[model samples]
Structures are given as structure tokens and as C-alpha cells.
Target: MESETYHGYNIWGHAIQQHEEPHRPGPYAASGTITQNNRVIEASGVLGFFDTDEGAQQAGLEWARAWIDSHG
Candidate 1:
């Protein structure tokens, strides 16, 4: 998946992505990332294999929001 900016955060990928490399291999893979001010502050860390990019991105958004709330 392509990196997308969501709510001031960058939702990065779902496996298949070079940076969020697949933990194992196969299909239905995914990942997520959170960025602020153009800097990656949080990431899924491990590639979360999902059936769809939407799911991955959604998770990422949720994570980013939670982090921001807790940290801020």
C-alpha cells in the first residue's frame, strides 16, 4: 500500500511495503504507521497481515490518536 497522511499522521503500509517488510511472507498482509510533523513517531513495528489495507490503515489511525491523547 502507499503511504497516506491521515489526521496529521502518516499511515504507512501493510506489508508488501519495503520499509514495513513482511514478517513472514504470503498474502493478506498489512501494517500501519503514525507520523507527526513529517516525522515517524510511532509505527506498527511488525507487519500486521490483514485482508485489506483499510483495516491496517484504520488500526494505524486509532493507534496514532491514542498515542497523541496519552502523550499530549
Candidate 2:
């Protein structure tokens, strides 16, 4: 996971590798979260799955930026 602070909002990239799940074994999914006042305000689930960690992270970051632009 990676995190960044922008405009007082904390954005996080959640990229987890699925090790045992039959549906997505050995792959990663991109999700995003937003935190304000040290609490999570928005969290995403399974935005998309990717073949590489970098791809997942990029998706998460892009999603987060768009969300922040609309919500912040």
C-alpha cells in the first residue's frame, strides 16, 4: 500500500496480491481510500485487478485523484 497527503486529505492505494483465492490467484487488485481527520471517509473495493503491482497502484492512484477532485 502507498499513501499521499493532498489538500489535507490522505489518499491511499491498496494493492494486494491474491495468493490463495481461486478466482484471482497470484494477481493484484487496485482499490483506493480517503482519510480525513485521521478517519477513513471513502474506501473502494476491487476497482480492478491487474497483472502487476505497478498497474494496480497506478489504477488506485488515478481513482483516488479523481475522487478527491470531485469530493474535496
Candidate 3:
């Protein structure tokens, strides 16, 4: 938790919420593209994911699996 290195990804999605709590930081990543009939929110973050593009895509897909449970 002590480092100057910032790790993350540059993706796109649709943001649903512009509201922010007072003195509360907004989400590290906001929805860039809301797919799945708006049921799925694609918020992007590093999460210390894969190093390569292919790996990151796979990582994103894997992380997306959780949305099924939340939306289902």
C-alpha cells in the first residue's frame, strides 16, 4: 500500500452515476460501456490483471462473470 506506481487500464464505458459522497472519492473506475441490455456495467480497473492485451481481455471477460450473479 506504499508505492508511487499506479496500475490500471484505459477502457471505455457508460457511466450511470455522477453523484459522489462528500469528501468521498468516486469509483476508481466508472462504466465505460454498459452492455447486456444495460444489465451489465463495464467498469475498468487494473486489479493487477494481465500484462498483455490478450491477457487483459481474458481477464476482463473472467471478471465479467460476476455480473451474471448480480443481475440474475
Q: Number of the top candidate by TM-score?
A: 2
RMSD (Cα, Å) for all candidates, in order, is 5.0, 2.1, 12.5
Per-model TM-score versus the true fold: 0.50, 0.81, 0.37
TM-score attained by model 1: 0.50
Residue 16 of model 2, lDDT score: 82
Top lDDT hit: 2
Candidate 2, pairs of clashing residues: none
Per-model tally of clashing residue pairs: 2, 0, 7
lDDT of 3: 0.35
Relative to the unseen true structure, what is the C-alpha lDDT of residue 34 in candidate 2, on a scale of 0 to 100? Answer: 87
Tens digit of per-residue lDDT, candidate 3, span 15-47:
223234564243322322224433434554543
TM-score of 2: 0.81
Candidate with more favorable, higher TM-score: 2 or 3: 2
lDDT of 2 by residue, 10-60 (tens): 888878887767787448989989888989888888888888888887788
Where is model 2 more than 4 Å wrong at Cα?
A: 20-26
Arrange candidates, best TM-score first. Answer: 2, 1, 3
Instruction: Give the per-residue lDDT digits (tens) of candidate 1, residues 1-72.
Output: 556665666656554433345564434445566677877787665545555557665555555566666766
